[model samples]
Target: MSKYDPLSGHLRRQREDELELTFAEIERILGAMLPKGAARQQWWANTTDPHTSHVQRKSWRGAGYDAFLIAGKERVRFKRVR
Candidate 1:
């Protein structure tokens, strides 16, 4: 069996299943919410503290801020906060 086959049984037993998004749907949302080209690119490239969602670029201090919104796996919708 394939490597993925072993995980299939476990994955199937999960309380929640993966959600699929169509390319068109993703494009539409990004088009409306994301800032133009360069800004959007910069945002995704930056990684911050996953817990506080604070950016730590250039310093280890907890002063940096999140530049984008994201939804946790258990979250039903994306919440924008800065």
Candidate 2:
């Protein structure tokens, strides 16, 4: 049997609901990951509901982008296209 085993399948099934990435950090990382002049966007806010004011009860969406709730840390990873 091959020694290399892919973890993506396992990780995907056991995925957590939250992640964290700093704006600058993600930007830099994505920048390096993506080519120059690629369009990159980010959105963030307190993971609380405006109406209920309950923590972990709300989330906001950004146009042309997807959002992830990263608990405990303030960072995320993303992809961009040129």
Candidate 3:
């Protein structure tokens, strides 16, 4: 299983339509630090194309959510999309 599976599981367990979390909070859920790339807004794209190398996309997208970066802030907003 991918390390990000924990994040997917966490999202799956949420009852809110939308959830906002600081990068630190996500790291806590993953039990590891996010890669440096995570600081880039484009890195948080909601792209779900199977061929994409952005594996983290599967965590939220597979959990029926889409990820949106909170510009200038180290936070991400996850909105249920499915």
Candidate 4:
């Protein structure tokens, strides 16, 4: 299962198309601690389905959302696209 599945369901229930969440919040949704430097680099590179490859760098696309960083990478904002 993709780490973003839980978060996808949460956002869908909220009826929100665009939302931002802190790294801590993301961890809670994923039910695991994020890898080091998760708030940096290309963590927002959501293009491919994460379940397709456990080592893939793709972000939220597996959950049907496009993601990007905000507040200088302090938070992530995901926009529903599917």
Candidate 5:
């Protein structure tokens, strides 16, 4: 199981269309610290290409959500995909 599986499960249980979480909060959910790359917007890109898919990307996408970085906020907004 990927370390991000917990994040996927968390997102799957959410009913909100849009959920915003601080980086610290996400780290709490994952029970680990985020990589430095998380500070880069590209790290949150919804890359669907399997060859390039990372565990973090797979987590949110699998849960029918897309993640967007909240600039200057140290947070991310997860929007449920219709």
Candidate 6:
């Protein structure tokens, strides 16, 4: 599977209302450790606008998903917008 497949698979299995996932859950799904800043708000920013170096995470957008921080970085919600 590709590095992004885990997240893509999870999104594929999601119900219409089943959005949002914890950062830990995402890390587990990826089967690997995330970057130190993975839990930071800037890590998941909509970078399609201004370019950013955190391009690896753009995988979520490639799969039609977007993330929003909740509970001050305790968790993140992966919402499918497309």
| Cα RMSD to the true fold for all candidates | 16.1, 14.2, 0.9, 3.3, 0.9, 2.8
Q: Which stretches of candidate 3 lie over 4 Å from their true place?
A: none
lDDT by residue for model 1 (1-82), tens = 3222322233234343233333233335334332333233343344544554322121112222222323332111111223
Poorly placed runs, candidate 2 (over 4 Å): 1-14, 32-82
Worst 10 residues of 6 by lDDT: 49-58
**lDDT value for model 1:** 0.30
Q: What is the TM-score of each candidate against the true structure?
A: 0.21, 0.23, 0.94, 0.67, 0.94, 0.71
The model with the greater lDDT, 1 or 5, is 5
lDDT of each: 0.30, 0.31, 0.92, 0.66, 0.93, 0.71
Q: Between prediction 2 and prediction 5, which has the larger lDDT?
A: 5
lDDT of 2 at 33: 40
Model 6 lDDT on a 0 to 1 scale: 0.71
Error of 4 at 59 (Å): 6.5
The 10-residue segment of model 5 with minimum total lDDT is 46-55
Which model, 5 or 6, shows the larger lDDT? Answer: 5
Kindly give the stretch of ten consecutive residues in candidate 2 with the minimal lDDT sum.
Answer: 1-10
For model 3 the local lDDT of residue 36 reads 91
In terms of TM-score, the best-performing candidate is 5
lDDT of 2 by residue, 1-82 (tens): 1111111222233234433346455445334342222232223333333465422112121111224435435444322111
What lDDT tens digits, residue by residue, belong to model 6 across residues 24-77? 888899897777776677777766753655555567776667777785756777
Which runs of model 6 end up more than 4 angstroms from their true locations? 49-53
Candidate 3 overall lDDT versus native: 0.92
Q: What stretches of model 4 exceed 4 Å from their correct place?
A: 48-59, 71-73
Clashes of each: 0, 8, 0, 0, 0, 0
lDDT of 3 by residue, 12-52 (tens): 99999999999999999999999998989888897868888
Between the candidate structures 3 and 4, which one is better when assessed by TM-score? Answer: 3
